[model samples]
Target: MINCDQTLSISNGKMKVAIEGCCHNQLEEIYKTLEHIENGENIKIDLLLICGDFETIRNTEDFNSMSVPAKYRTLGSFYKYYTGECKVPYPTLFVGGNHEVMSYLWELYYGGWVCENIYFLGYAGVVNFGGLRIGGLSGIYNDRHYDLGHHETLPYNTSTVRSAYHMRKYDAFKLAQIKQPLDIFLSHDWPRKITNFGKLDDLLHIKPYLRQDIESGKLGSAACEELLFKLKPRYWFAAHHHVKFPAIVYHDERTSSIYQSEEMNSKTIKNPDEINIDIDEDLENPDEINIDSTTSQPHISEDERRDQIPCTKFLALDKCLPGREFLQILDFPEANGQLEFSYDEEWLAITKATHEFLNLSFNAVSLPRESVIQSKIDPELRWIRENISQKAVGLVIPHNFQPTAPAYGEQQTFILQKPFKNPQTEAFTRLLNMSNKINPDGQSRPQE
Candidate 1:
């Protein structure tokens, strides 16, 4: 039996990936930077992962919909790619940030092509790339709306537009139910109290303003922290608080890997006492902590204690701009170079199983009781095994790219509101026989 510290299986060969921070629509500079790195190192980057703030502004309506001030709201290079004026050089995947055009992203809420070769990771999703089980949660977390269902519709008001990207409980809960291990997890916000594990002194040396938020435990996301503790992925990458910070989260107290880079400075940044970090109830729990509820994912076997250490290598990069450390290229030589993009069976089952409980109401509603959701999945799992698990190339993610909305035109400022539901999302939901909850209106449509 695999122990708690063990990760999911790797692929036959390796994959080269470039991880980018917030993409404030600086497409030219980002590609140039990647080319510079590739030429300098004499290597190729297979995939590009943008953490958030990708600013997929296609038209003037999208530009108007973005939650930015007047000066910062200009449409950038994304429209050229959307209109076939240019093509993305590499396969790119990104989550939504607060600064995204919610009109387009919500249309692809179940995750679909923004255009050819560019994919949105949905509100929360898990997929396989080069044998790495990559899981990502789009949008940021807000304490005020964390427990509420998605309430914002298109033609958003001042408040709804901002709350549109606020991470919802339904999305987070879906992610927490994942039993399969994740290799890489991308989140826009840093996990709360993450400052404790990394070099705090070095971090403060640059962003001194963080000290107050760090001391008060006000910075980072509680939802992210809870997921970090719960998932324990091999590597976690984030961006939102514009800074390049690295840290090591050790699952087993006794052991840790010497992850290179400057998470910890040469010797030490300073003594732990210098910056106060609160180690609360989450951290106090040991590696083999059990979920006691019916929804508990019992992946690790009984022979799990003390054979090896499990740790999540956490790194967060800065937004795209001059003079900021916003990109890093990582190589997964242990991955399966043979496999193309495939769907994760467990995630698909989880999605199908929990589709009924998918909430789209506009008010603060508590998540369906764990026992209720668990009961729903038990029967659905059998259907999944018989249908999804039995076909040839069954879990392969279909190259489903189509334009359901109008494209950016020359000098085209104002376009129509998103009227048609994204064809990609509609097809994906239809494939699983799940109800299409995404709509122009924030509320779910009546079930047939």
Candidate 2:
């Protein structure tokens, strides 16, 4: 039932969007690529979407938190932007991958500004830009840590650091509650069996080792696959495989039905033995725990379905390197009024309704009971309408950025700074009238 198509939707003015793959901390090269695209194509890009591996390392201490080998680690261009030493040429938005500073990302679990003009999508979130509903889930999917909570904290050890970025079920389940349409959706990894819809022969030529996994029907994230079918976005982009591949997800008409209730998350864990596995250090190749991913299930109107295909165009790019297909430029419809970042109403409502379910301890987190959550959404939506949407500032994500860590290469002596509450996260949570779960005591660090 799967097929291929390019056209999605269209309008008057065009919004040229550039999509990049794994940054690998290559900000200078990425900027050059963006420059080249604009010069060659003779069109200005409105936004830049980075898929992951964006190492936002502020100091040497932050570098120690990455999962990569010591030899490959370096304070890349993010620090320059963080220190006001350089300026970003485009509005860059990104999700997190395994190679990121997990401690920094964890501080903004509900999504906040990592740097000026650069936005982190948190663990899982949605935002609107220039008439595009962009939703993404940070980190790659790992079976062992999928069912657990955010138990990892600062000063990570070898195991916890690596597991910190693994995608969690709680975030995935929250994303499933969305009911509106997404113009574009991003994930750090490709959806499972996605090769079935794309240029498989070319993929096999580059990644011959992946053949065994692909044939065994275990190549990508099942949660992503479920969301792809359910959200049915116009376009889906991903990175992390280090391959430039295109796949079109054709949604069945039946699958277009929205998941409005919470019963869809009740899946039986496959193995009880894995249940007793140590909570901090994960076991490799652990037994699978399924998330019956529910989706808001956007109903595309006849006019919205370009060429009447009813398919989500999916493209996954390679990492930033010479001769690699790491960048892509696509056209989206321009904004009707102004092009700026705004918070999605339904996403905020979901956050408000489910904030009580957030777990930050080593203990395994439980999903909010379906009955309890089902009843809370209505009241939360009403609260959002009265408190957020009707506010003087409205749903525009505020720009309250401030440096919390030392500049990347400052002359100051090496002083390790532990994580502090991000001002952006504090402001965001305060706007929602929710308590700041990240730094409950409102602790902060002296600006270096």
Best by lDDT: 2
TM-score, predicted candidate 2 vs. hidden true structure: 0.84
Model 1 earns a TM-score of 0.82
Instruction: Compose the digit string of candidate 2's lDDT tens values, residues 1-448.
Output: 1123323211123786778888888887788766765564466878999998999988777876789998998888888888778888898889998899886787788887887878888899999888788999988888888888888876788998888988888888888887788888988888887777665777899999999989997788888987888788877888988887775555755332231111111111112122211223211221232223365665553323423547677878888776676776666654443467888888888888888878877666789765677677768888888988898878888876787666656644544444677788888888778988876653365444
Q: List the residue pairs that clash in candidate 1.
A: 11-335, 11-336, 12-336
Against the reference, the lDDT scores of all candidates come to 0.72, 0.74
C-alpha RMSD by candidate, in order: 9.3, 12.2
Error of 2 at 76 (Å): 1.5
Distance from true location, Cα of 144 in model 2, Å: 1.2
